[model samples]
Target: MSYLLRCITCGEEYEPTETRYTCDKCGDLYGTLEVIYDYENIKIEKEFEPKGSIFQFKDLIPATSHTPIDQSIGGTPLYKFKGLLGFDELMIKFDGISFSSSYKDRASIIAVNKAIECGADTIYCASTGNAASSLALTAAGTALRTVIFVPSTIPKGKLTQLLVAGAEVIPINSTYDEVFSLSLRVGRKKGWYCRNSAINPYLLEGKKTGAYEILIQNDYKVPDYCFVGVGDGTVISGICKGFKEFYDLGLVDSVPIVIGVQSEKAATIKHVFDKGKPYTPIIEPANSVADSISVGNPRDVIKACKYVESTGGHFISVRDDEIIDSIKEMSRSTGIFSEPAGAAPYAGVKKMIRSGELKRTDSVCIVVTGNGLKDTDAVRSGVEVKTYDIDEAEALFL
Candidate 1:
């Protein structure tokens, strides 16, 4: 159960209590710390059975205590889809069923619990939409106050969730990258606990649980590939970590090839992976219908790239139209509705198959990160709102 924080860039180690976000020596983006557990000393029950809550894997989680939130946080359903999307074996991890109707709840639970554990009264973060709402939902009735900074273009449904949860919403007329920097500065000045998953190491621990659940639900069978939408890169990083942990414990034979799916409009991570270079701050604005993954310069690009490459995975970028089309295709085919970002993985899968990078026989798992209801406006063009009179409706029956 004991662990140490290690800087990914400099390979420096520190006691868990010594630092919060990053390494003091490395600083900022490169200073991002990763939790290194003592795998040799750890032990698990022989008859281990996965449970409905994330707390079931508390032995692997970093927190000593949990928040008093009543709602269940993790344990989303893993559904199988045969002969769908032109794949012989396809599975979707529907994290949209999370408490906040988004996958970000996995990280929010840990962040909120960490805030309380540190005796902090306020928890703040900058998010495109899902993460903000997830944080607000997790800290709703807790003593911790939630403050969210978001772009002005955030969907009304997400804003409504934040307002209903009593979070102090700050809308900035700027890109997500700018808003993120501003939030980091303000959070540091105010000494508030930050829940941004990109910089927070403990939040990654929460996210890795998704990978654990996926493997468990599939009867410990590791899939050939895992496709996830990439934004701040926290979700994919956490997933890779989870699979690595399972592999470390000798539970699974190997890790899946984790493919990160991004919008072509905001494919910073993809570009970096293609170039074989370190992350540099991007100035171009990233505008996409997939608001959640529309990040110009992801802060967690380093870890995201490292983790993906370590598992022999790569990045794929899909067009906005492709993502929109996949939203409809996924919903009609599987009865599972996902936001644009959540559907990006499906689009990427189609693209890869067309490019011959993916084969129809390969077992694939697409992670649906958020619920479709989070951004109904993005799908307006693909759907119709129709009204018919009683007589007109009856004519169709004839």
Candidate 2:
């Protein structure tokens, strides 16, 4: 590994010997720990072909020379969005259909690699939905002991995914915050490796693979803009970090204008962006169909604001009805089924077009984050699923 784990605050890079979970000096203020890479040795060529998954660009990542786990991750599709926007260059990078059906799988694979390298057999984590499925499915590669704690109100489909992955699923009737706090305490006492992004510094590195894959597929050219939905802001930050690496390596000319999408109901960042003030410590959370972006208190909101502001990116918020409609629109137009959170980019793109926020020539990419299967509650009502005998199944359609 040629990278140093750096604190977002002090700008001091730590050596491998000094690698700890968080920054030693400015742990509280930094808010996020960033992995700084040695970009000088990197040579970005237009001819390079990425591996079938994220590993295809291993040379561009901060992975151990001998990756401990060789599981399939990354390499999701980037499809063009049609009809709504007049822009010819807008595309939605599909991340929902990851190995276990969420962008979290990218992080899960790498997190598990680190855990396996450290020789941890048992793993535990707290997630509202997507991360739980990712962790369990990735951990199933080795079939090592894994446990997932999620909110009791999680979609039945997501819960079923965890069970099928051979993970011990525990539902806490409390909110995600309560479940997260309890899991941390229990995890420390039980010696289980914590897989939550709140505690893991390398988790960002894993999630950054989405950016890497897109760049690789596009011949290493960074898009003019990248859009993502924000939960705790880890995924958005991850994408930014990936582009930063390419820039530092001289692989790309400039970083993309990072666009953050949040549910209008939980539009805290939008409030900060619109009011032209520093973040307010307290904000109210409202209910929305995009439950994935429902976190009122984002752990990395400070970093998110800093990244967007420094890179000249903007935060966009969309209403719940718009999100639901975007999900259907994207599926119908692109044939890429996505959940509400996954369709968030579509809503943002539409808003941009109507407001004349984006130019016609700009090359843009939207980060669709979760599978449509995760929350069938929204789509199940409108779409019909038919069951028939084998003999009549094909004949009826004909």
Best by TM-score: 1
List per-prediction Cα lDDT, in the order shown.
Answer: 0.88, 0.76
How many residue-pair clashes does candidate 1 contain? 0
Clashes of each: 0, 1
Could you tell me how far off, in angstroms, the CA of residue 211 lies in candidate 1 after the best superposition? 0.4
Please list the residue runs of candidate 2 whose C-alpha ends up more than 4 Å from where it truly belongs after superposition: 16-19, 25-30, 64-71, 81-84, 272-283, 382-398
Model 1 Cα displacement at 398 (Å)?
Answer: 4.0
For each candidate in turn, give its C-alpha RMSD to the true structure in angstroms. 1.5, 3.5
Clashing pairs in 1: none
TM-score of each: 0.97, 0.88
- What are the per-residue Cα lDDT tens digits for candidate 2 across 1-398? 47777766567777643125566676533545777666677676655445466666676555542333444577778776543367776777887767778999877877777677677778888888899988888888674689888989888888888999899999999777667778877877887777877467678888887877778777776788888998777888888877777677777788889999999888776666666646433455645678777776566666667677766898999888898888888787778889888888789888887898888888889899898989989776776778999879878888
**Which residues of candidate 1, in runs, are more than 4 Å off?**
45-51, 277-283
